[model samples]
Target: MTISMNCKRFAILLIAVATLGCGNQNDIGPTGRVNGVLTNKGVILSPHTQVVFLHSQGGTAAYGGTDEKGNFAIDSFNDGNIPIGAYRVMIQPPESQLGAEDEPSAEELLENSNGRKAQKKDAEFAFKYRQLSTSGLEFEVKEGENVFQIDLK
Candidate 1:
């Protein structure tokens, strides 16, 4: 009986050790803050343009939005830092006034008055850099602060 009890305790301790070693460590990987300006033909992009940093290895993407001055900061995993890796950059132009005008008003949305409507028009620059596969823009995120000036022409 004594030997059996000792074996059971040893097994439990071994299992605990193994479980502790298998913890998720990806969240603890090295990361860095990224901020930059985006310009098109030497002019700053419009405010509220969406920017995305897609990891080259396939994982959760980092995202940001440009201000009126075309400044942005990349964020990932709910934090304002991106994991160190190579990333493909994608930029989505701000929604056009025509698209905004086509959207149902708050009252209509709340009352479900508007049925399905015509698709809104895409922005002039929507398809230009909105796709990571076609953006042709790439950058590397390191273990410290990263600043860049991206020009689209």
Candidate 2:
């Protein structure tokens, strides 16, 4: 009789702790803080690469790059947290390599004008996650801080 009472009490306590969030899980509010590390296989990708989270519902995209240690956080264009929903992730070279929009360095311009080719540095990632449809990486953002350890092929 005592054993059964203890088990029942434990179960009730577990359920009470599980549902201690601010409100209903379904109501995730406006946004969710999204951050993670980009990894290839088991190794972290620390190169100058950008991660893009395209909203599954086609609203906006949250994008950011990893630091030297390979950690990244994504923010929308409005400088706010990512909207709560599913998103398709894409990894690519940073904005500096997009060309035209980013101005070249003075030395690079001089080298170009003098017919001397400027040395080009490429991002270290070799896998094909540069496109939304090809990456095959998806994540759902819930309310509060969402940490993802995204591992790629």
Best by TM-score: 1
Query: What is candidate 2's lDDT per residue for 17-121, written digit by digit as tens?
Result: 887855664442588888888887777775567888988985668788888777988876555576789999899766565564233467786868776444444
* CA-lDDT, candidates in order: 0.76, 0.75
> What TM-score would every model get versus the actual structure?
0.67, 0.59
Residues 1-153 of candidate 1: C-alpha lDDT, one tens digit per residue: 999999999999999989887677566578888899988877887787777888788565878888989899987764787778888998876655334554556666566645643333543353447678878989988998999798886
Q: Give the TM-score of candidate 2.
A: 0.59
Candidate 2: residue pairs that collide: none
List RMSD in Å for every model shown: 7.7, 15.2
Candidate 2 local Cα displacement, residue 3, angstroms:
86
Candidate 1 Cα lDDT to native? 0.76
- Which residue pairs show collisions in model 1? none
